[model samples]
Target chain A: MTTPLYKKTAREIRDAVRSGAVTATAVTEAHLARIAEVDPKVDAFTQIWTDEALAQAAAVDAKVKQGVDPGPMAGVPVGVKELICTRTGKTTCASKILENFRSPYDATIIKKLDAAGAIFLGKVNMDEFAMGSSTERSTLKTTKNPWNLKCVPGGSSGGSAAAISADECAMAIGSDTGGSIRQPAALCGCVGIKPTYGRVSRYGLVAFASSLDQIGPLTKNVEDAALSLNTLCGRDPLDATSADLPVPDFTKALTGDVKGLRVGLPKEYFTEALNAEMREKVEAAVDVFRRGGAEIVPVSLPHTDYAIATYYIICTAEASANLARFDGVRYGYRHPGAKTVEEMYVLSKSEAFGPEVRRRIMLGTYVLSSGYYDAYYLKAQKVRRLIKKDFDDAFEQCDFVMGPTSPIPSFEFGAKTENPLEMYLADIYTISVNLATLPGISIPCGLTASGLPAGLQMIGRPFGEETLLRAAHCYEQTSGITLGEPPIA
Target chain B: MSKITKQDVEYVAGLAQLRLDDAAKERLVREMGDILAYMDQLNELDTSNVEPMMHAMEMTNVFRQDVVEPSLPREEALMNAPVHDGEYFIVPRILEGDAS
Candidate 1:
């Protein structure tokens, strides 16, 4: 039997749409229909943009009819995490404060993808302000792992990753601040990329941690991620921090060549912290590289153990400052009974933010508070320098640092939520990439004995996404993980 | 590492403008204590001579040309405001006034 149109990769769908094998409308409809069928079981979407997506797809079909080039991401159904600003619908960040807040303008990537002919299937759930390691922190709804409804689809991009895993969308755009993109991608068995820190624009991404936050795509495989990079990369005048480098055709880098490439295995990532099965899966990935004619080098990142602690301090500090914009006077939820300005600010914020959000804010405030700034915040910034230096030193010896994305695969809901610090530990392998401003990709490598997916994370040098994509493409082809459907309906 | 106290949580809450009731404050005191204790690990690293890195990729003073660019219109900008007065965001009385 032929694969469903919804199950086709974005590249295949784009080619078929261009060649007239299928209409963009049909592709969009199939995905929408699939979402209707499976998203309820996965709870992936917070709001499905049925009408807007159809309109976008219809325009793609119209372009094909008129012989107009429909741009690179043609006819792809894309799910956007709710934190990204989209003028068509509310950009809630899965929080009560902005639950109904409509953005006046679309984010830079949103505008770019719309121009590229990708349909916005809808806004999906995420941790409130993209702050948590699990979707449990999302105030909208909990997004579950597609492989097992009982387990969490790792977050704060859980909705984006789960939607792709469940065949609800052709691709998804997610933000990574302390592994929000890669960790979830790892758990859900999707290929998620967090490009070099300033490689993509963050103009309309509601800032979680300004220095750490970056936007990238979560797709079913590496090729589509390459295509997404082709469309999404380059300097954005809207975002000051966005790099001015020339955007390369990332697809060309996926030549599946790994001979003579040096892959660094950071000894710290494979230590006792990693589960035995996860370690075995990652070690198998090392063998895949060895067999592919790539040299496996052992590198030490001595500061690796400090990543989780350092990331939490820096991110929360930034989040505390970034989230200060949600005052009652501006857009978003506001309590009506305040007779004084001070009362309004306090009451509105207290009522709007969730528990995790509140905890982070308080922590952030404490770190930046006058007496403690140098001790907590400044010390973390220095420690962050050490973390980045470790990567720099490692990259000097190898092309990519290879390891497991998360310490383990997806876990049952509420397993780590009780202890915020425990949840933070899940992202240990991914946090340093953000801290160092390097590109990283998490592609499915193997599944656990019980049938959950494990991801092999590859960290590339600064602005070295080309090599990383090539390596990911190469590893994915040879690695024995079979791309199979989840047990869900 | 210092112990995180209820007073500290309350003080930080005031600074962050999040009004926390007693239950919330109690919860934060414990949670923040555990988290802050974990952060003490950073104290182990002797960063005496290290410069603090604020951003991962450093680009300083990115200035755009001084050209006029259209921004979101007042109406569209105010569309999502909870208490907008058409031309402005209406807020609670800033000055201390008589008790209601």
Candidate 2:
């Protein structure tokens, strides 16, 4: 019996391919077989393209035989979040509205990954239009945590995180708009990074909140996260928002050095509201940094308390405008027997969108409406500036800011579903980073007393991914925390 | 200061074109009220002279050239629709002047 290829990290699989010990076809086949075996129980994938993945892996093997060096992600299997466009497969955004949608062309990142010889495993599930924090809001199917099948993986990118953690794929790409990627990564016990807003191209990424959305990598460890980011980052002409900056060698920066580094622990982040177990795990991670000759200082982000409210308003307002394109006439689901175009628009959106998505769209529409725009959307934008200023000031005093990614570990599937306010509050610590347009990462720090993984989040200055990765890499090395595998039957 | 009402929720849902059930409306009313109450903190911060910001970093006129590019064909664009006429979308009559 062969060990599952999905159980290994991208780097491990890449090493096997490089050494010729295992062919790319073998690794791809194993992952495809594993998805077939496990995805039904977990509901992680929205679309599985096994035949296409096998074909792609065979082409990669052919190139390797001809002495061609496929780039960093060579022969590794990865899952694309359903929101991103893939030429060969369907891209639904996990919404009933776009349930049957297929892109004629690939997203910029997809094209790049294909060129690097990475095989596409399939499209993973997500919240409808990436609105809600939990995959429960998906119009298609719910994505469950691999750790506890009843618990959510923490979403909109819940499926991607669960897929990676459950050994469904070697790695997965997810988007972060108000912590969609990191929150789920934390909950699922995987390594996920939300690159600085413009660091990665968002051209073909279905816009959630343009300013807040960034495509990032979800992997089993810090090193794989680095490798995935290497292929995904850089400027693209297709996306005007993509920064015209040089892509750094993220792997080269992971030398695991935190000596003489100043790490800031935001006092506001550790509050009475935070779960005691979560705080303890995060603090313990900070101790590892302290032991590595790093100084931990008490810092304050005074504006942090208002982050959730500001993030919700701004993100929803932007989403309402962005989603206006799906009016049933141009694209997506349409009402079968509507009398007029307006009725068609109404019926399509109402039927296609899940509850949380509709809630956001409503809130967004209200905020962006003529009379309310100044009081709500404009005010939120101003508050957003102050929030960013707080980070700018904090970064001057310390190299990175550390905190708990979520107030609690993975919760039951419908725990907060009834109360939308509670769900919004779950993203408290994470939304500020998006508002600030800073780089942030979530790495597994320790397991809670309940044995579920807890993540310690680190925030760095704008375009300061190198500093943040170095700090995380240092902790990852010294902490001696081995990756946990899901008990997939 | 954050005085939200059921009417406000209804009005917003209408603007969003959402068909909310009684339970959803009640739930949204409560949640939106709580959210608005939390947002009252903004009123405390004096903004007499402070300028409202639209983006975090100072970026201005971030646009691309209005270049003509290839677009998806009509058939491809209509691929995701649930129901479509030959060249246009088909829907129930929402306004008058239609065969009911």
Candidate 3:
């Protein structure tokens, strides 16, 4: 049987649309129909941009008819995470505070995707302010794993990953701070990349933690990720932190051969803490690299143990400072019937923010507040430097680091919600990559005996996405472990 | 490791501009204390010699030519405000009381 149009990769859809073999409207309609069919079960989307998407897809069809280039991502259906600002709809960040808020302008990546001929599939749900490890924290809706309805599609990009896994869209844009992108991608059996800090512009991305947050794509395969990166990456004057470096054609790095490459195996990542089956799957992936003409180098990141602590302190501190702009007087949901502005500020924020967000803000406030600042924030920053140095040393001995993305596969909802620290530990293996400001990708390594997908994470040096992509693409193509469609698809 | 008291949660909530009820304040004291205790593990490392890395990557002040550039117009800037008078944002009350 031929693959359904909804199941085709972004590249196939783009080529077909550009060649007029398929109308962009039909493609959009097919995916929109697919979304209508499945999203009720998955609850992945916060809002579906039906009218706007059809209108945009029609424009792509018109371009094809007029003999104009339909751009690189022609007719590709993309689900944007709610945190990304779009002029067409609300940028909710999965929180009630921004429930009614509409961005006056599109984010840099939004404009880039639109210009590249991609159709918006609307904003998907996320953990409030991208704070939680599961989408259960989302105020908008609960998103379930497409692989198993009971299990959580790992989050703060849960909706993004779930939509891709369930074939609701060709690709979903997600942000990673403490593995929001890579972790969810891993759990959902998709390819998710957290590019090197500043690899992509964060101008229109609502900040979770300014220093650690990054925008990336969650797609079915590495090629799609590389294509998305080609369009997404570039320095923007609007984001001062954007890297002023050339974004090499990432697709070129998909050199099917990983011969002579050095892959680092960190001893700390493989421990009693990691589920045995997950470790075996990761080891098998490493063996693939070894047999495929790549050398495995054992390395140590001693500061790995401190990654979670350091991340929490720094991220919360940054989040508190960044989210300070949401005063009641300005845009977004404000508390009405306030006798005074101070009361309004407090009531507006407290009333709208969910539990996890308030917890983070409280923790952030405590750490950044006067007396405790030097002990917590300063100490965490110093440890963060050590984490970076660990990666620096590891890269000297190897091209990149490889391990299981999450210590365990996707878990059932409410499993870790009771203990916040436990949920934070779900990102143990992926957090250090963010702390070091390196590029990381999570590809479907293999599945467990029960058929849950396990992700193999690859961590590379600063701006080393090309190498990460090459090795990932090599493993993804050569390894026989294909991620056949999730049952929901 | 230090213990987090109810007063600390209350005080921090105030600083964060969040109004928490008594039950939330009680719950947070215990939760935040547990979290802070775990975070105390960072002190085991001797970071005395390490210069704090405020950002993951090297940062520099980015400058553009001092010239006129397009920016958000007034109406668009106030577009999402909860309460607006078209020309200005309307707020409850600022500065105690200025007899209007």
**Model 3 interface DockQ:** 0.87
lDDT of 1 at A475: 89
Model 2, C-alpha of A170: deviation from truth (Å): 1.1
Whole-model lDDT, model 3: 0.92
> All models: lDDT?
0.91, 0.85, 0.92
Query: What TM-score should be assigned to candidate 1?
Result: 0.98
TM-score quality measure for candidate 3 = 0.98
| Ordering by lDDT | 3, 1, 2
For residues A272-356, could you state the per-residue lDDT of candidate 1 as single tens digits? 9899999998888899889999999999999999998898899999999998988877788888888778888888899999999
lDDT (Cα, tens digit) per residue for candidate 3, span A1-489: 378999999999999999999999999999999999999999999899899999999999999999999899999999999999999989888889998988999999999999999999898989999998888899888899999999999988999999999999999999999999999998999999999999999999999898899999999999999999999999998999999999899999999989999999999999999999999999999889999999999999989999999999999999988888898667877887677888888989999988998999999999999999999999999999999999999989999999999999999989999999899988898888888889999999988887788999999989999999999999998899897878863
lDDT of 3 at A130: 95
Candidate achieving higher TM-score, 2 or 3: 3
Q: TM-score chain B for all models.
A: 0.86, 0.73, 0.88
Query: What DockQ does every candidate get?
Result: 0.85, 0.52, 0.87
Report the poorest 10 consecutive residues by lDDT, candidate 2 chain A.
A480-489
Model 1 lDDT, residue B48, Cα: 97
Cα error, candidate 3, residue A74 (Å): 0.3
